[model samples]
Target chain A: MPMTTTPAEPVTPAGPTVPGEPAAVAEPRRRRRAAAGWVLLPAVAVLLVFFFYPLATIVWSSFTEPTVGLANYTALFTDGVSVTVLLRTLRTALIVALVALVVAYPYAYAMTRVSRRTRAVLTVLVLLPFWTSVMARNFAWYLLEQRDGLIDRFFSLFGIDGVVLLGSVTGVTVAMVQVMLPFMVLPLYSNLSSIDLRLMDAATSLGASRPKAFARVYLPLSLPGVVSGFSLVFIVTLGFFVTPALLGTPQQSLVSQVIETRVGDLLDFPGAGAMGSVLLAVTLVVLFAVSRIAKPTAALNQAVDRA
Target chain B: MPSTRAGRPRSIGWGLRLWVTAVAVLLLAPTLVVIPMSFGAGQTFAFPPKEWSLRWYEEFFSSPQWMSSVVTSAQAALLTGVLATVIGVAAAIGLDRGRFPGRELLRSAMMAPMIVPGIVVAVAIYGTFLRWHLNGTLLGFVLAHTVLAVPFVITSVSTSLAGYDSTVEVAAASLGASGWTVLRRITLPLLMPGIASGFVFAFVTSLDEVVIALFLQTPEIRTLPVQMYDSITLEIDPTIAAASSLIVVVTTVALLLPQLVRRRRSES
Candidate 1:
């Protein structure tokens, strides 16, 4: 009788109870909701201790070491070697990014034109290198580009003998472009695939030549991918260590190499910290500048969505 | 859309197709060359490697030093995968379900590792870990690699979480299910794919990571990639080709396993 009474009573009462619950339940639920955010504490804590704190230490050491007041910062400008290396890094990254873009655009376009089966094959080709280890790929390049390696031997058949590739900027750039083409192609392919084919047909029917139609219709829509891909390639190349380190000589050392030498060889913590901070600053500035110009946030989201 | 007009511009299309094929070959050539080169009969890296031999593979498999580095790398990668996934999944769930101030800022902060250059991170970690006396320690390797690997996990888990419906959790709650039960029965099952992928990704990232390992490496401890780096830069040995091919095979298999699992699940 008690169980039956409880069940029967609640059936009628529950309908009215729901309407009356908000006043009592709202405050406590809101408080509970806020407390749930603390679940992020462990991750935030780990990163703070390991990531942000270390970075802060580097930034702090840059000023405080060997007497304070911007000496390291000033030395970045005054020291010819540091400045030259920084400039060279920027120059080389730009060259690599542009060259990769040139190679990737056509490949990505071809991917869009192909059938699904063919596209899958092309994608695997692009991804094979990406999935391979950087050390392995760079080593392959090292063997091929060495003085009497495959590339040079092949060049000899064309009467272009004794060409120097290894230990040169050309060798480093070639390897980098190969390594980075996937980064360029994937973004460009996603952007291109999303494009409507009719727009090209529409532009061509409106009396624009094929190239003209592509420039006016396709190129503008594809600009977002281009900007995102180029910046991604450039930023990654800026901090590249493996390819440049193996293929390049001291004369062509990038800023990352500079940082490594300062810390490892010279034991110049503050000097290396200064260089690291500068590189970080430049990367952030470039990232923000690109995001501002091209809505890279949207492009990045699209890329991630497709992935 | 214009298949009927395809023959109008045949020459240019032919040329473009050829160029794209060439680019694909260029991308594949470097990685493929290692397969043949790894079998070089000569001591040095040589083109067309005069004769085929498995001596380098024997060297890789037989050398205690090389085998130990492989073991060390695998141990670190396994630890990194577990640590990063636990931390990353919690952060992703918190971001998804919690409504609080600075939530966007926290999300970006979690992702910052991916954007920050690797060498910059390596230098920062090296400098800090040196002072903390963490350099070259196994704990140091796991912690530092976790910092790099966590972002990938967060990205993967967040993507999966974005598609999850919260109304089912609310329904389970109203039926008197405990919070943990709802998470275990409803949420975790849906998120299993993401978690698995995240684990694999973190593992591969640690295995592939060289810059940080290079800085943090002690003479007592070294990862396979660091060993390969030394072998290539400090000495040009054919044994490195064997190591590289092994890495390529292992990583490709690791990356493909998740997709295969998903395909099987969908089919069933």
Candidate 2:
């Protein structure tokens, strides 16, 4: 509801006017609202019939398909593969969120302090990946992560050997962290820029050390943004498919890969549906929980709109 | 905030500055590496190719499969962009101009495609399209992608509408212009930048999307990304580098086109 980033929508001022205009204005207003309703019908109807209906069918099949009980959901737990992949997926998502937060916080903080031109450049850098093709970026990561590639060479210089990033969870995580950083930075920047830095200044002036002042004041205030950023990154990484599939081996598969296999190779629609349903549930729950503390919608809008 | 006496800028120390620079490099370098790799003369996925040529680009341009996929992708993206812009512009106008019950609810519904995970939508749409026999069709690609692309259009148009002055429409109406004419002559012109941006974003969104495209792809009707994906996973061909660079360049220009348009509009 706190669409803080967007300016308020202006009310239309083209309502009907007549010489005797009191009661007649009400009828025209009703007609205008109806006209607006008509304008809205096409897009809304298309999404509902195409998008939501399909989504619901898949979720429904998770329950009703293959004998109409909780079998599919129960199988997800009892089946060793789904549970392991689910746990690995959760663990990977958490690591990506934490790592992105560490990198993004200071970068976002710097964005606030820099001169306007510098800020513009930094903003462009942050957004560059967002605009770049996803497959292209992933391809570049593949080139770097492949055997004896740049990453291996970098590690070799430090006397570390056989450090192949490809076909491993590490490769996927490294690529994913880059993918998720913008999501983290934009929200954190939005939150950080709004914080009254004077609080830190006030604390330092009161004889508190600068570090302690920041710890007690700035860090706490930035938590909402941190929470928002973490959840957003976490939720996205949960259902990530392309990166893990491209960089990772089947032996170290994430939940997304498992879901893909179930639907694509195995043709186990019910099973895949169940897994997809759980992924959707987790995403929504995390978003809902974050919404309570921070304006996830506002954070998401800032991240997406980059305004 | 700087404490009036010490009116220098906020003291972002060297450590933070260094970290930010490193982060910026980390964000940008990987994507840029593809450009050079794209022009590599070698067959293997080698960096700093011992020799250099546009061999891969030549291959990409010559291969019928790649060419056909390119055609499919271009057609889908163009269709998705146009269809989404129209529906989204209408929805933005509806949301902006109308005061109705559940208006906020409807607005949130428009954004749902963005919130839902890509793979989920891909599978769901894949499954549903299968039942409708819509899979492997341009209409399928367009409809699925339009769902994804519409949200971008809606957001862009809504942002533009937020800053728009509705009084111009009122002025036109008071001068006895018809509702449709006022909208056509005044409202649409004022919102052109937003509308243009919305179209570009939608175009780019459809152009770059791969998850849903992958699900809906058939051997006969696949897109460039599906080809690029196959080249990566199914084969070790380096020609994907050329395709990747081309895509990155195209999408970057498409995304920036709006910014340039807006800047030019403001200057004019």
What TM-score would you give candidate 1 relative to the actual structure? 0.90
Q: What value of lDDT does candidate 1 attain over all alpha carbons?
A: 0.80
Window of ten residues with lowest summed lDDT in model 2 chain B: B1-10
List candidate 1 segments past 4 Å from native.
A1-32, A293-307, B1-12, B253-268
Model 1, range B176-214, lDDT digits (tens) per residue?
A: 665566668877888987887788778878988999999
lDDT at position B132, candidate 2 = 96
Query: Highest lDDT, which number?
Result: 2
DockQ of 1: 0.46
TM-score of chain B of 2: 0.89
lDDT of 2: 0.83
Report lDDT (Cα) of residue B188, candidate 1: 80
Best by TM-score: 2
